[model samples]
Target: MDVAINYLEENFAERKIKIQAQEYLHRFYGSLGFKQVSEPYLDDGILHIDMLREK
Candidate 1:
């Protein structure tokens, strides 16, 4: 996952977009520079968090 993200980051330099993932998936995206945005919240009965990587 990290390798793929690195490739995307390197390849998508002009997108100026943000990538987000839930808390459970935090570690995967974190390795690629994404940061936790806030505490977990209940969404559809599951705990969710927002992590984002800015372009």
Candidate 2:
């Protein structure tokens, strides 16, 4: 996933976005240098979090 993200980041110079499956997945995203935006909240019985990484 990291490799794919790096490819997208490099290929899409105009658009900057990263996605994860769930809030728990934030840790994986963090490993790739993404930062959590706020506390996680319940969404359809599951937790969700927003994260972003600037290029």
Best by lDDT: 2
Q: What is the TM-score of each candidate against the true structure?
A: 0.56, 0.67
Candidates' RMSD to native? 3.1, 2.3
Give the worst 10-residue stretch by lDDT in candidate 2.
13-22
* Regions of candidate 2 where Cα sits further than 4 Å from its true position: 18-21
The candidate that wins on TM-score is: 2
Q: What is the lDDT of candidate 2?
A: 0.72
Worst 10 residues of 1 by lDDT: 13-22
Off by over 4 Å in 1: 1-20
- Per-residue CA lDDT of model 1 for 1-55, tens digit only, reads 6566567768866333354456688787777677788788878877777776665
Residue-level lDDT tens digits of model 2 in 1-55: 7777777767876245645347888878888777887678887888888777766
